[model samples]
Target: MVNIVENIRKQIDDAVRNSVSKAVEAGELPEFEIEEVTVEIPKEKSHGDFSTNIAMQTARMAKKAPRQIAEIIVKNMDLEGTYIEKVEIAGPGFINFYLNNNWLYDSLKDIQRLREEYGRIDVGGGQKVMVEFVSANPTGPLHMGNARGGALGDCIASVLERAGYDVTREFYVNDAGNQIEKFGISLEARYLQLLKGEDAVEFPEDGYHGEDIIEHMKNYIEEHGDKLLDVDSSERRKALVEYALPKNVERIKKALEEYGVTFDVWFSEQSLYDSGEIEETLEYLKEKGYTREEDGALWFKATLFGAEKDEVIVRNNGVPTYFLADIAYHRNKFLKRNYDRVINLWGADHHGHVFRMKCGVEAFGIDPDKLDIVIFQLVRLYRNGEIARMSKRTGKSISLTDLLEEVGRDAARFFFNTKASGNHLDFDLDLAVKQSNENPVYYVQYAHARICSMLKVLESEGIKVPDVDEVNVSLLDKEEEIELLKKLAQYPEEIRLTAETLEPSRLTRYVYDVAAAFHSFYNACRVKGEEEEIMNARLILVDSTKIVIRNVLELLSINAPDKM
Candidate 1:
């Protein structure tokens, strides 16, 4: 369906064309531009529906007062087949139109006709886009910080799919990093402690200290037997360390899925190693003169591409750094998969690393514009005014699994969507559990379920959902009823605007507003058996509200249960 804004613009265009033709025919001013007309929502809803600066823009050219131009434009205006209730020049010649309720009733009819597919458009036109997110190293179960990325990435993928993009969700496993090695050693110490019944653990102070490591150790002992514990060589040790990667990744994957975060691809860091892509990337960078020898290791002169200083790509031991593998990984995403675009969802701490990746992307011959990096600021979780900062390595960061256990997937998604990505979020568990007041997620969900309850009650009485378009929408003229239709009519514009800004928080706020509008309409009117035409129209409006609320909640990856 055409968006209401565009539809209104067409009406304005027709009016302007007639007005301009009259002026040209009368020779008021030799040829004037009629291109500056605009129709945008007014701040004060009571003033008018949408205000346009077209009259003011044309006043200077027409050599008339802005009011005079507005009068001429209004005189030529035709509201036939449109919803324009009134057009007024107010506050220094601003032309504002008040829309009649019919505009909204029509949108409600379309919503009933479209159902799940309402508010949808083919804006992407079938572009292939890959989203790589929550690619946290497989050193342990997802931490609370990782949970934020998981929820965000999953939500982004959902929205893209709705926007008609061919979306692929990817999780990059950095199993070949220093962090993984530390994780394996931590498991080894736990293995020894469990085998020999030794009380003291040989794990380093900086290694993972979570109790889950003990479980991993017991499983390894059960599988590998006692001989595996006393392996003494560095080569065998690294082999055993690499052996634990799958186990760690399995734990991470389970936690994410349980939290309602799903990925289509698990792109391994070892693949970059296995395919010699890291070596090829370094050599390619060398060809670009971005590599140099520093401190007996090869470094990428990232400063040339706006880094604070050069970064080592490979150590003296000939092992490439994590960053090299990341570059190699992204290189394949564009070159091999041939994705039209790549979106990297990284934590705030990785902000400094974005420049070099962009630099490396350029050096690899792919346009840097194609690689989009979204850096989410750090998340500070709280459980009832007290901060939750339990870490696995330091025992100071909250476990992601535990967070999911405390809050269901719906609440977790709501928690993440509560704040803007750029702002630091204090995800309070207590707030998430609250049923009412300021908790936007539950608030919207409650509204959805209430309507379902009302529908079921009506259903029991043999009332079926009406074909609203078949009904006479002209009967729906009550103030609150008209208000809902207006809100319903704005869905297309809302979706486009949210996608344009890449701001899901826009929907977060919008869901509450939509719910409030529906609630107001519900309480102020009684439509059990009154005018069948208006009854069907109101039902359609309610149905569309439910559908849009669900769409918005789904975009945030929050469940829109018919029962809260």
Candidate 2:
């Protein structure tokens, strides 16, 4: 809740506005109304700590050159009771403010006082949000795509929660649809081939060909041999589906949980059908004149909602398409569950479905802007400096379980989130498992561990981290110490930005920066061997750094080890 950087930025903004007001009152400048003030961190260190373009923004209104206006504002500025150490006019009309180390000193106190809650901010205002991701089909194991989506979605949900949203992490179970039907066919054919003979039945070309399908049938035969051989094929397929679907769903659940993601809702796609919501949605669309019959099939006029053409909601055989089911599912999310916002994490293959789904939600009287779809690109796993297409265990596309087994939960999640969701990811298995600083997760975790080890050593020597009031934090004015404090102060702002952008990759980069700063501070300033007062001040700084690193790692669901 305590954002030191935001607090300082607001202070700077107010001081700048007041200076302009004072200038206007003194008749040194024309009287003009100021609507807003903008303040931001300077990209270069020489440009000062914070910069604003108020002079440029008000030039046309003030009827004066921007540089003249900037000089007048600086002359009238009062630096007392503020962190502004010096003000400079740079590059045409930009006003930059250099700060004393007060903000950095205050940040250490805030971190110590807030502890684990240091980075939390109330940007969401308790609005209800549902993040649905990794809704893989129940017929097969989760692949590399699911791995990336799981990490990104789960971390995003965590970021939202930290930003004070009432967030629900959900996994939509695609347990019913064309894929389930194909699953039944695959299981039935595999069952017959194992019992009757391979030549007795032909596997459908569109059926699933994963080894898990064959394993499911073999397990079923081992438990109950040929019990469905005499039954009708329809009944046999239903029995097989009933026996295998739950296991597959359960496997998916276990894999996700192992990958450090637990869904609050495992919403089943079949629930919409069984609850009659699908039928009701179709009827509602028909009543609204959005539907028509074409070639004996019921079609929804998708072009009205910006689609390329009309779409079939129900086929001529009376079976509903997945599109209809999807509409009903979103209707349930918005109208029934009453979430203020819903986010879906999907693979890039679903890019074309994004706008249509938004259109569908709009037809239900829901604001389409509330529906956010994050389409992440594919991930290609690499091992031994080569693309790894097959898992050593399954000899198939590498599963999430296989990825977890190969590197680890921390490395996998960290590496998957190292890039923006829009960029294609080449997961380096070799780099992920490395123990050196080349591995980012290792580097960050080592920073935390190094601090912990240092603290333990000092604790044995009867030198504990002192309270904020116990030491002079002004002693932490060294270059490396100031840079580390600046990084620590940016945590709350980082959380706010991550929530706004719905990007967990920001935190990954941020924590690495914090680690880098800590490493720099560790080498430049000696915490253990310094003078008593300086050592305690550095101890407090180091302790605060540990808290921030752990906080970010916890948000990403990665562990911070006490030893590396």
Candidate 3:
């Protein structure tokens, strides 16, 4: 809960307010109500550690040039008790605060005190949220898109939990409606062809053509010996689906669990229809005048909610559309279960569906803002400078299982999370498995391993990492040492930023930058041959870096191997 960056920002804000008040009391500037003060890290270090544009913001009220106002505020500024070493007025109207090394020392101490909890914050206020992702159809194996979604959704949930949210990860199983109907048809064709030859059966043009269907039928026949061949076509298809659907769903679960993702809920779409939720939701929509009858179908007035066209909720044959079922499912999340917020991770093709779903929620008298849908683009896996689509092991299209088999789980997660959700990713097969610094995950893990190795050698000679109070932290004044400490101090702020943006890629980039800083420090400074006091101080610093790196890796569901 201790955010060092936020603390420093608060300190600077109080100092700025007190300074302005003193200036007004001393008659050095006109009296006016001050709005909320803004503080941010300066993009360029030459400006200062932190900068504010309060003077520019107050220019009109003060009736003076911004530089004049800034100078007046600075002259009356009191730097006592604040961590700021000095306050300077920069170009036009900005106030830049230079901090002493004390903030860096406190950051190091906090890390040692909090250990695994160093980067956790309370920005979410413990709001309950449900994150549903990688809800691939149960008719087939999960592919590359599901792989990426699983990584992003899991990481996003972890970040939210760290930010003090009551988070639940969910996977919606599409085991009903049109997809299942097509699945049954596909299995029937495959089964009839296996029994009566391919020429006797006509496969539906829209049925699933993947070899998995054929395998399912083969396995079924091997067990039953054509017992269902004399049965009705509908009954035969029903038997095939009953035998295969559960197996496919189980395979999906096994693959995801192996990839280090386990959901809190495995929701079934069929449950909505079975529980009469779909009918209840449509009746509610009809009561609200958002629906109409046209062409023997029930239509929704989507244009009233910013959509360019209307949508059909139910077909003429009395079967509800998938969109209607989706509305019912969300209703269960909000109205039945009472979650404070709900987030859905969808593919890029569902971009248009976002607004319409939100509209559906509003039509039912619920606030649409409670729902958020994030759309992620596709990923292209590259091998030896060409697109790789087939799996050598499965002899079919590459799946999440195939990806995990080729590259380890850690590489798959880290590489998939290196970019934001909206951006397309080009995953390179060669770089992911490389053990060298060319690989970012390996580079970060190597930093942790390097520290572990250093600490091991030191402990062998009876030189253990000392406590913060035992080490003289002021002795760490080298350029690289200060840079590394500064980087260490940024962990809490980075966590806050990543949570605010709902982007785990930001956190991934933060750890990579920290590793880079540590490498630079290790090359420029000598921890082993330094003086006794400096060695102890550097040891504490090195161990702190190791802890932060491992913390982030654990958050990402990646391993921090000490030996590697």
Candidate 4:
């Protein structure tokens, strides 16, 4: 849980604060309250390791030119017991601080001490978080949208766990809804069509047309025979639904498990109605005056909570709407389960639903702000420079299973996570399966494999990796060596920031950077033939990189192979 970079940043800020306080106390500058002093890492290395614009911030209150204030601050600065080697005023009032390599050495020590736990941080303060994703209808096969959402949601949960939140991965099963009704109708139609002629029963125009529906009925006929044919359509459809729903749910679970995702809760939508939570939620909303009747339908006053218009919670037919069930589901999440925060990963098609859902949660006497909905744009599959709409195996829409079969689970997860959720993703089939460095996942895994090979060779040569303290880390003065250490130092801070932003894609980008740094270091600095102390330090550095790279891959649920 040690963040050496943040520790150094705090020390730098403290030093600057002390310098400002001393100048004010000595009456060399007018007294003024400092609200916040920001210490930032400079993008350009030569500008210094850390930089602050404290003087510029104080210019108005000090009634002096920024450069003059900077001079006074620098003259009063005390650098004792700080990692700062020197401080300089650059470009009008920016105070640039150059540090001794001690902080870098300290980062190495932290990594060795914490090992796999190095990147962990406690920024979340043990808040309960539930991430619900990929609650695709249990009708047919899960499509590419579910695949992307699964990877993003699962990785986000992992990041939150590392950042110190009690995280739950949930999949809301739409087992009871209009979709299920349609599923039953579709299965009945397919079943009857198999026993009778295809033209004997008319398939509903809106019924599911996927081959899975046909297969489900075909299997049902084999197991149960044609007894269902004598029953009324309603009784037969109900029986067909009872038989097929479990299989569909099981298939969904198996597909997700194969894709490296497992849910803490497979929350069923029917549970809300069965447990009376939906009825209770409606009554609660009515008590809050958020519900009213219009056009013979029970309407929620969505406009009261910033929605563009009111929405129907219950139709005139007296059955609850999906919107109503969804509100109750969120109510169950907040009031019954009592999660401190709930995040939903949805497709961009749910854009309008987001506003009403937030309003619904707010009406449930909970803070709607705690409900975060990230609408990720859909993923389009491309193979050989053409859009791939049909799966070769399923002969229908490309499913999560099909994607896993073609690109591999590791590549699919890695590629899906390469972009932020807010952006559209074009998943390139050719690039994902590439074995060379052109593939990002292969490049990253190869870095790990390369290190494993190096470590093995060194071990066989009787050159073991020494402890961090046993080597003189100052021997790591080469540019590549320092760059690699600097990147290692960033992991902890990166974890914290990614958690704050709720963006798991940052972790992917970070590991890729670490891989690049390691590759650059491998090419420039020879770890084997160096003098004893330098070789030992580089060996420890390389080993530390392997740990971090593997840790990140594990978090993303992608395998880190010892050999690629």
The TM-score values for the models, in the order shown, are: 0.87, 0.95, 0.96, 0.95
* Candidate 4 Cα outliers beyond 4 Å, as residue runs: 28-33, 53-72
> lDDT, candidate 2, residue 160?
96
lDDT of each residue in 1-564, candidate 4, tens digit only? 677778888888788789888998999899898888888889988889899998899899999999999999899888889889999989999999998988888888888878888899888899999999999999988888999999999999999999899999999999887888998999999998999979989999999998889999899999999999999988998999999999999999999999999999999999999999989989988898888898899999999998889999899999999999999999989989999999999999998899899999888778988999989998999988999998877677788998899899999999999999999999999999999999999999999999999999999999998888788878888888888888988998988888878788899999999999999999999999888988998888999999999989999999999886
Model 4 earns a TM-score of 0.95
Ranking by lDDT: 2, 3, 4, 1
Give the Cα lDDT of each candidate: 0.77, 0.93, 0.91, 0.91
Give the distance in Å from residue 136's predicted Cα in candidate 2 to where it truly belongs.
0.7
Which of candidates 1 and 2 reaches a greater TM-score?
Answer: 2
Clashing pairs in 4: none
Q: What is the lDDT of candidate 3?
A: 0.91
Give lDDT tens digits, candidate 3, residues 1-564.
988899989898888799889988998778998878899999899888999999999999989999999998888878888789988888898999999999999899999989999999999999999999999999999999999999999998998899899999999999889999999999999998999999988999999999899999999999997998899988987899899999999999999999999999999998998999999999988888899899999998998888998899999999899999998999999999999999999999999899999988888677999898888999999999899998879778999989999988999999999999999999998899999999999999999899899899889998898888878888889989999999999988888888777789987898999999999999998888888998989988999999999899999999998877
How many pairs collide in each candidate, listed in order?
A: 7, 0, 0, 0
Error of 1 at 21 (Å): 9.0
Model 1, span 90-113: residue lDDT tens: 877888888776667667767777
